[model samples]
Target: MNDSADYCDDFYNYVCGGFVNSTLIPDDKNSVNIFITLNDKVTKQLNTIISRPSQPDEPEIFKLAKSLYKICMDTNAIEEQGVKPLFDYVEQLGGWPVLKKDNEWDESLFNWKENIAQILENKFWVTGFFGFYQTIDIKNNTRRVIGLSDYNAGLARKNLIKGLEDKSVLNYFNYMVNMSVALGAEQEHAEEELKEALEFEIKLTNLTRPDEDYRDQTLAYNPMTLGDLAKRYPYFEWKKYFNYELSPSNISVDNDEIIIVSNPDYFDKLDELIDSTPKKTQANLLIWKEIRSLSGFLNKNIREVNGNYAKIRTGIIKGTPRWMKCTNTVSSTFSIATNALYVREYFKKESKDNVAVMIKNIHNQFIKLLNSTSWLDEETRINAIKKAEKINQFVAYPDELLNNSIINDYHKAFENFEMIGDSYLESSSNLDFFGNKIGWSELREKNVPNMWDSFATRSSTANAFYSSSENSIMLPAGILQGEFFNNELPKYMNYGAIGGVVGHEIMHAFDDQGKQYDADGNVFDWWSNSTNEQYKKKAQCIIDQYGNYTVKEINMNINGINTQGENIADNGGIKAVYLAYNDWSSNNELEKKLPGFNFNSRQMFWVAYANTWCSKSRLESQKLRLIYDNHSPSEFRVNGPLSNIEEFSTDFGCPIGSKMNPEKKCTIW
Candidate 1:
């Protein structure tokens, strides 16, 4: 695998190749080519249905067909179900016309509000729903520890204990719980099947590296990771503490230095600028404030429950998982844990330099990619390049922020576990009910930085995102290694796998959602109405097209209406990366093709792009996603976009009118 050709094969076989084969459903010569030849007809029918107003006595068959079509095209069944349920729920709560009867709230509406609140509360518990609450629980020897999970979970448990305090909400919760329980019972069979699939991935990883140690390997880092670690040590969940370290370093402002300021003054400045910020940026900031407030409240609650703060602290430290310790030894929280794990597992130390170099090289390539975009206006392009240049790259760990006294001070402030827990719930509930007044002042404060540093720790994390509010892109340390990046892989493979990801984050600055924010990371609309309209029209075409797809056997409809922004980003990111790759090839005088692959780098680029999104999900999960998630499923993500991209068809030699090559195309950026 060290040689370029071997590296390419390893990459093609292990990473990008799997996606190409898995997602591109081969056309059956004997079967009717419904998708290939009748896309227009199907699309037209879907459009007609979408345009029509609700009518009583509509054909049941039409409803079923439309539902099935939605399930297939959209890759989300849950969302499809949500369409009718949400509409019904809203209407039942009070028809939209009735709710909108008054511009302002009426005292009579209090019943409606109370009903809605009860329903929301009930939904929380059954669905692991949580809301803010204050409670104290005794631990061994009269000590206490604060426990915080999803607010919904707490709320649901409380509702159960209180015997369904609100009848309307209680009934809803009961119905949902019964359905979920029944679903769980039915799903037991499917779980067996899925276990094999999951185990297969694990086995593949194990088989591929038989010589490597497996005892210490961990699943991807997430909030779930904390849960997993807590199973081994019920006394404490160390993932929380580790998160405290990782999140702050993840903050970036327009690719500049990763600044984690807790100064009240900074919060004040941010408040002053909020009105001037773009809507999306403001929305994201508000959301972050909500999340942070929740986090703080959770910490406070745990402290209040535990009488001995030191014991609670010990539990947190001792609960640090072995894998996290190995990954983040430099940090005080994980240093002892890492040493203990190393000794326990007898694992050899790997060079941090290798990981650092990979990150640096990828970061540099992304910068170069940003320099090559032809679509951006010169002024925008120059600023984009400067932003790329300014981006501070922190690979694998925090710099020196760990030593800040704020970390210690935060620990000291939580002198009582029960009070901390109560404070957490109160703070979170207040934030939710009253809006972001705390955020306004907190942003101005320069006392301590917010955000956890676990994002920089080693472990596997599949997710990545660009924070418009922070003006930064975060690649968790866990995702930096593995199939996404390896020094041994060919540049094409790297670009297609991790390189495409880097490009994706970089291009996010210009995505429909991200573009709302300016270079400074403040949200403000800068596009002319004409340009914005043009983009929206193009985006709508994609929505309509995607809305027409169906999942076999399910009566579902994908909501292209909801998923438009993500679709735009997917299409635009692929284009930007491909262009960037071409620029790199031309400037560096690299070989036009990898040995043995017999494809030009340009062709490989699209293939790589397709491969990154290869995934399989349970039908139930798929259904759930349609209702909630913004992105389309993996199969549609590959097939839908590829069919629309002329470049992809040209490379694959997909004849016109083929499933992969449609006569009509939709383009938006």
Candidate 2:
């Protein structure tokens, strides 16, 4: 605590100022926060698991994961190969035009759609020209559908639209040229051709919807058959492309198969861009996307060039350590096995039961708040409470993870996939296809009942998530450690930290985005029209409130529109958890206070909450996050929510008009 600082003026500073001022951001890290600290701990634990030599009786999945890590860590193997693997990959794509002499390249021999379909078939890189994947149909959570949308380019739409004048765009263009030359293209020719390709991407950016348009589910839910898609936008051969793309899974799609096209307007505009652009330039851009995607996996020279671009984007003084990078890669690639290993070795069984109890208490508190909220009409209130009651809470690891049969069945896809001990690039390339095989295998199947396992093998991640499609919240075992929770901690401390996290996820079910989904996770409007209007009116106040606050380091204000969902969750979460704690404490005996603390348990509750967000970040990273991150800066996350809760000011005895106790406060829940 900063004893000299006043709680009323700025509670974040009062609690976290001393720590934030004293801590230095690590050279390799862009920012240091409670979440990052916990993630690093998880990574280190994974390192310990993978670093040990494989036991004779170890599971095949574990052996495979360790092998992947070994290949990544063997820097000598990568350096000696030196761009040959990438050069061979380009040749497999029927050659990049920039790499060819003017007469050596034949335009008639190049078929852009064939190149794209082959890339999609291998699943080496996803975004180029456009993107397609299978996800749960939002309108029908029981089934999955093929989703099509505009290309997620190498650069964001905002940066790409800025043209070469923007430093970020210029850096990207330079990266393309340097990488192409490294792959044996002539420098002057590479630059000239890539410039045209860069312009083509800029045109591509204009075809997509604005970033905010994607927030609403209804705008993106255009369902059509493959036949209809081809008829509507005849420039690309949709049916032929998908038939080849889905061949690996042996699942063929007829023209009548229903597909979800998220950005219908993008396809309408895309036909024009394709007609005006040259096939050669289009080929250059497509192959360049491949080069960009695989650069980090290649030699040190390629990674260093890519690293320079990353330094400009993220503001880190050094790259991540090799072991750390390899550890994370293995964790992602073999998520289920790694998650199983983490739970068996480190997670305590009691934490799950303890956190579940807290979840129930916080859930009941949310129902109470919904019942009392006057802005909601009777029907809206009933529907809101029903949704809250039905929410699926997944605490820690899944029960299925303990079953060896299930783990083995999940990893059976890798049995036939070949991997060389020393050839990291070929191994990585093969893994991409196998990874897509797992994904494409999900097409047209019922949603998995064990939702935690169905997600991107992230049960080992030190983060929590609210999935609106499933109408569920996942509290992975990885996040239930360190400052978040422990079996021995006081209930008040747990409620203030992890308990708040539980409430936050529950609030997401009613936030701007999650509210669109009904209790069954279908995208249906269950609220009364008048109540919906009232909800928006309240939401606007929060938007205006947060938009006014500025980050001094970056001279930028928070994107209130972009971050409103998280802000709503943060504000409502604190209220629910605080009330839940009060109710429990009143029923039980008063908890003992912490040693050396000059405050009661209630005051300590606020302190624990504030300390959870104590962090220091590089200014360059802060600037980028301020523009792109969906949540507010850490300081704002702490101060912004505490200031809105009346109990906080009362506990701290703040003056009514002070910064932490502003007369006009925004509340949505």
Candidate 3:
């Protein structure tokens, strides 16, 4: 935890270890990372808007966001209402057997088929045994396509199959059974029923492919028609199910609707599993998933139950603060509206302009990296440079957030939901209806299928991303503040922090999965076979490098394959930003350092880079992230890249073969 330790040996500690030791994690927070810290700051800013009394001058969407947040904050109202609203919902789905009177479970009302139809009609996105969502077709980004993929079984597939053998898995099982008991079933009956439900989820997980399989877009993209889906997996009533989902909306479909079934084999296996599983068990499983999905919106008891259960799996000792949780829900439900208001206050045009210049600097340096990389042949290098140059940037926020006409259109999309009752559950249901239909009308005009759209995450998010489909890097306003960037700060600091972020996202376009897509965002590999092969060999070095770094508290090694894309991006991004800083510094020729620090500007650049990633995580949070997150821990993020960079070794004057100056280094741009 020494702050003055030689950075060349362990830079993450030299920069962050003391900070981690000094900071106290709030009772409500499981862990605090760079992203979490910044998000909390933004949430506080949003609280000002949410907690304020309604004003006559406020924008229409701003009013909507405030109303939603209030309902989320009204815990007394949520608790007073009790389980009646939830019971009413379950009754509409034909009632849960767990809630039925002893030996009097009615077979007539609990029709699984009718229940599913009603669930679909209500626009409740319940991912039971199957999941359905709309996205731009991977093969054709211009058009939207419906994807009925595998249901997640409420946990990661690996943990789900491992079952009770894993401590976390056992905790989740106890939670499922506890939920059943809370709803008024006999304790023994609840346990027995939920055990069968767990078995059903296990079988579902076994049939599904792991996350690694989806990394390759070529393998992931499986385009087929409705007719083909039926032909391939005859067990599912494809026509009836999809028609039920689409009938309530503007989307129309029949046997000819072009659907993208990502995993045909999983569906085939699922068909067999579904046919063999009992109707009662299927009903129990589906209802349990729905209950799980909606429980948090119910009374305090239900919310606490779900939160406690999630804590076991996530290592989160407590639930997020009620205000923060509500803000997240409201923001996601009405992102465009929330973000439109978000843009006016904390985010402005000036910050966007600064980010634009930084983006250009990073992009130019990235082009050089692409052109100069030795691993890629001439043909591959030229295509890589084209992809890099074509990478468009959406800085701070999208332009539409500032346009009244578009914001009004989006606001009008949910106008009907304005009259939803004061209760949280009531508003949630209305949002389900309003949220589904929000952009559906436009699909008919554009002939676009359901696609990914989120202005809130895009507008105020504390992280940056590169969308392979859009071939663009999005830098949200939330990440624009903090140690990441400041216009008044020295150029060295900005380049090390936000400059690296822009570069990281840009480099994602050439990462393992991203390289599968071309400059046009189409799923086409432009690399020669040899270049592709060589790229893997170099990437393996990173996989090995990161895989060996253990999360000491949990003693879990990094999942390298799952995180390879991010690892590559980290290395490539730092390289890009460093070189970009050198280019900028040489041209501008500015000389300044922090008033008290002894480090030169060149040394400060790397120090700033490490500081941006400083964080403190609890054991539970660390354990969960090791299994779930794509990026390695913040510690390894600093050490891994620097360990492989010769410039770092030279700057720190580390001898050859030192901990930070390995003789062999891995590099890929």
Candidate 4:
């Protein structure tokens, strides 16, 4: 029998010598190679797990155990040494919950104003380090200019204060700052702890050197099981322990009673509009429109603001700068560009039919899932499904906004570039003064078409997101590739990975935050009081569950208040994906089995789903994410959901009363 310490040493050796050797390559110019290597290792491990049989051997389990063991070792090492100071400081300041409860604690009311002082000090530090402003050459149609850094700083500061006016937003900022400080401190501590743990573990074990392959030996020794891995590593064990009591219940499987409104024609018309236009012309039109839009805004405000510059500057410095970019073209242009690129590429693909099929299926699945929710009242469920069905699926991209004539027209309209810049600034001031009187129609008419080119270049990103305000889910071409989606791979893999991602995005419409918006993307109380209360109760359960997990020696504090929306989205996404898969399965689709893998197509689906999220983060990045990001760590995302999912447990034959299977599970939509 192997001693626990010996096991630890061997695991350490595998991580440093075998795993790192296999994944990481040293290069002088690129310091981030270690992170990349770790990411690759995680991806490879997930793939292996996915390919494993339903009843994996001790070897398979041990491999997973070893990987997780190393992860815990690395994480704990950082938490104890690097992040402890910040954690302690934040704890002393009052944990998030406590600080949040003190709503009436105003800086002016306090004797010393500790909270306000800390915030001001941190703001100064940030301004000093990052430098605050940028200047743009309004006349030359170029970004080059002086005073831009100050300008940008002023704008950033203004935005920050505006955000702070809302108590929730202010708290979020405070949380981010506190968390950032904590993460930075914790990273140093964790690194030192990891080095020491590695050294100690290495001294105890006999293993092959870093240069050699360990596949033969890995095959010889049966890898640790999940149970064994959790027991041996307290860090990993703690997550499972907490999850046992906190994991939310599975969503109901019956999705038949829901009303699904189908709009298979939305994308078709959008495609026809784009296909009729020439690509180069469309691209040129987009650029021309963007340039003109910027010029138009700058033309109006440059002079008016010049007169009030000192007063505006004072207000800005005092944390009360007015919103000056109500008529700004940058954000709108960016949205247009991103949307256009998405639309163009989508139409170009041979799988237009496939895209349509996916959208229709997503719509139908959401309707069914909403109707099946036992907790939601009939009226709420009906409205929720209506919202889901009403959601407009914009595929590929929007139609070209600029024609040659329109571009030329806008170009001629901006004869004096400097005046145009001043006019642009004036327009912003006017919008700020008037408030929503500028109207969406007038703004749309002035909008340009340059976003397509920008988006086409940035097409390789690996994620997709939903916008509650827009009631849209963007499926970029970048994430449409890889393990997530490939035309050649088996349907099960595609559905499990990419399809799962799509379903997840669709479900966001009904997640805690998204549900706040109605079908038309308006914020309104669409649910009954009883239903709303039930929803809150269910959401709170998820918050409590995730809040209990810790990262880097500090409790994650889950900010259930803040992250409840995202957690709900995640839970719903998984369920939506599963239901979408079932819908596909019912069509008598044939399952293809991979060679050397014991799992059938159904089992492989879950494995593929889990594999998509196998990733690692730097301690700093991880800490930042815990504070600012809505999603949980990737590990928790997989394990947390899998534990709640009976299907996953059943597929793996997870033992009853195992850490993964608790007696009570909290269920929500």
Best by lDDT: 2
lDDT string for model 2 (1-669, tens) is 687888889888888899888888888999998899999999999999988888877778888898898899989999998888777777766678998998887777666666632322254432377888887888988887898988788876777899999877898899899888877888999999999999998889888877778778899999999999999988788887787778878788998989899889888888778878998898899888888888888899889988877787789989888899999999988888888888889888998898998898889999999999989899889899999999998888888777778787878877666566587887887787788777887785788544647543767788898989888888998899999987787887888888878888999999999999999889999999999999899889889888898999879899888899999999999899988998999999999987788788898888888888888888878877876789998888888988888999999999899999999999988
What is candidate 2's local distance difference test score?
0.85
The per-model lDDT (C-alpha) reads 0.40, 0.85, 0.78, 0.43
Q: What is the TM-score of each candidate against the true structure?
A: 0.45, 0.96, 0.95, 0.48
The sequence of per-residue lDDT tens digits that candidate 3 reaches over residues 496-519 is: 888878888998998898888888
- Per-model clash counts, in order, read 79, 0, 2, 51
Model 1 agreement with the true structure over 584-640: per-residue lDDT tens digits: 577676655666666677777665665566554444345556665677766566677
Local distance difference test, candidate 3? 0.78
Which scores better on lDDT, 1 or 4?
4
Ranking by TM-score: 2, 3, 4, 1
Better of 3 and 4 by TM-score: 3
Candidate 4, residues 580-604, lDDT tens digits: the string is: 7777878976777967667777777
Model 4 clash number:
51
The model with the greater TM-score, 1 or 4, is 4
Against the true structure, candidate 4 has what lDDT? 0.43
Please identify which of the two predictions, 1 or 2, would achieve the higher TM-score against the true structure.
2
